[model samples]
Target chain A: EDQVTQSPEALRLQEGESSSLNCSYTVSGLRGLFWYRQDPGKGPEFLFTLYSAGEEKEKERLKATLTKKESFLHITAPKPEDSATYLCAVQSGTSGTYKYIFGTGTRLKVLA
Target chain B: EAGVTQFPSHSVIEKGQTVTLRCDPISGHDNLYWYRRVMGKEIKFLLHFVKESKQDESGMPNNRFLAERTGGTYSTLKVQPAELEDSGVYFCASSQGLTNEQFFGPGTRLTVL
Candidate 1:
């Protein structure tokens, strides 16, 4: 079965602190891995999509890197506004289906 | 252009009452998807619609949840006789073809009392 697992259920970081959140997955014929950030009382905001192993993407202060079996979302000198729940999802190579299997996100808090 | 949009940003209803949620995907987007995030749980895909066609509905929790995309423009998800476990945030997303990036709307927070 295809599944996604995110570690470090919750993290409290000092402002400007750098840390990484992990997203491990078990899927057959991986198609894509996605990173999303969700704030309280809001839906998820798209961050990045990594298609193949060794692929990487970045936006502002966030970087996402993908490997054969997992992905990492590295926050560089995060600010308090960067505090949000980071989510990970994977789409398999299943034909004709666009559904995404998600992980229980990692809640991040960057205290100022 | 405006991003995806959902109706009823928040709704609190009795367990047995019915509620309808709506979503308007970005214009020209052929792919519209529905998802939900239960309390303390990850966001889950409920269904996907491709231009008024049900491409996938495998993730819908039960029969009480009904989703439809009429005229290939906007969509609606009606939960008849909602249950307590149905409390969650219903989100709508849309994407252009050949791309995996889905833009989301401010979800509908459903609370069943």
Candidate 2:
């Protein structure tokens, strides 16, 4: 069975603090790993897509790195505006109808 | 360009009532998806439509849910005789071709009394 799990269900970070959220997965075949940021009452916004192990992507204060069995979303000196639920999803399957499994997500609070 | 859009930001109905949620994907997007998140639960995939054709309905919870995308344009998810367990936020997403990046809508909050 393919499943995704995110650790540190909730995190409270002081402004300027740096931390990392983890997403571990077990899938038949890894096609893509995605990161998204979701604010209250709003849809999730795309952040990054890591396709292979050793791949990394960055945007401003956020960086995402991938490994064979897991992914990490690192926040560097996060600000209060960076507070939101971070979601991880993995697309796997050799068949044409791929399955996208999502983690429970990590709620991050960057207090100013 | 406008992002994906869903109608009726919130809906409240009694159990056994039917509700129809609509979504208009980004223009020219061929892949549309429906997802739901019940209270205290992670969002789960409901179905996927590729140009008016049901590509994957395996994630759909039950037969009481019906999804349709006509003319490869907008899509609708109708839940007939909705149950308490069906109360949740319904989200719609869209992508182009085989692209993995999917844009999502604000979502519709459904409440069953």
Candidate 3:
């Protein structure tokens, strides 16, 4: 079975703090890894998609990097407004169904 | 363009009651998806619709759940005789095509008492 696991169920950071969230996966073939930010009572917003190893994408204070067995969402000098639950998901290559297996997510709280 | 939208942002019902959640995908989007997140659990795929066709429904839990996307515009998910375990936030998402980024709605929070 394909599975995605995210670490640090909850993280509390001070303003300007930098940290990284981990998403490890085990699957037959990896098609894509996705990162999303979800606010309370709202749907998840897409952030980045990593398709292969050593690939990295960034936006604002957030950066996403992928490796052979895991993906990292790095937050640099984050602000309070950036506090939200960060979710990671993976799509398998053979599913052909476009189904995404998501992790439990990392809840981040940025304080001033 | 308006992102995916879902109706009845929150619904509270007793066990055995039926609830229907609606989703309006972005205009011209051909790929629509339904996902749910149980409390403290990961969000999971329920089904996928390509236009008006049921492209994939392997994630459906049981026959008690019925999903339809008639005419390829709006979609509905009906839970009959809902059980306590069915309580969760149901999310609707859409994308233009395969490999296209999916846009999600605020979600419908369903609570079965």
Candidate 4:
């Protein structure tokens, strides 16, 4: 069974604080790992895709790193605008179809 | 270019009623997908469409759910005799190709009494 789990279901960070959210997965075949940010009443926005272990991607104050069994989304000096639910999904399967298994997500609040 | 869009941002209906949700993907996108997120749960895929064909319906919960993309354009998801458990946020997404990133819509919130 393929499963994705994210820790720290809810986090409240003071503005300008740095923290990391974790996403762990167990899948049959590893294809890709994705990170998305979702605001209230809006669909998730794509953040980054990590394909292999040791791979890392960054955008402004956000950075994402991947490992064999997990992924980490690090926020540096996060602002209030960065507050949102961060979702993690893993695309993996032997079948030809593209299947993404998602985690429950981490709700982040950056208070000013 | 406009991103994906869904009609009727929200809907409230009684159990056993039918509801149809519509989605219009970005122009030229050949792949469309439907997903849902129940309260306190992660979003789950319901089906996928490639043009007018149903590429994958493995994730569809049951036969009461019918999805169609006539003429290879806009898509619709019809829930016949909807159940209370079916209440959730239904999201639509689209991509140009198989491996490309999918753009999502604002989603439709369905509430059942």
Q: What is the interface RMSD of candidate 1, in Å?
A: 1.4
Across A1-112, the per-residue lDDT of candidate 2 in tens digits comes to 8889999999999999999999999998888999999999999899999999999999999999999999999999999999999999998877668767889999999999
Q: Give one digit per residue, the lDDT tens place, for model 3 in B1-113.
A: 78899999999999999999999999999999999999989999999999999988998899989999989999999999899999999999998876666789999999999
Q: Model 4, B1-113: lDDT tens per residue?
A: 89999998999999999999999999999999999999999999999899999988999999999999989899999999899999999999998976666788999999999
Per-model TM-score versus the true fold: 0.96, 0.98, 0.97, 0.97
Clashing pairs in 4: none
DockQ of 4: 0.70
Worst 10 residues of 1 chain A by lDDT: A91-100
Mind giving the per-residue lDDT tens digits that candidate 4 earns over A36-102? Answer: 9999999989899899999999999999999999999999999999999999989887655888788
For model 3, chain A alone compared with the true chain A gives a TM-score of 0.96
Question: What is candidate 4's CAPRI-style docking category based on DockQ?
Answer: medium
* Model 4 chain A weakest lDDT span, ten residues long: A92-101
What DockQ does every candidate get?
0.74, 0.76, 0.78, 0.70
| Clashes found in each candidate (C-alpha, N, C closer than 3 A) | 0, 0, 0, 0
Report the number of the highest-DockQ candidate. 3
Q: Return whichever of 1 and 2 wins on lDDT.
A: 2
Q: TM-score of predicted model 3?
A: 0.97
Clashing pairs in 3: none
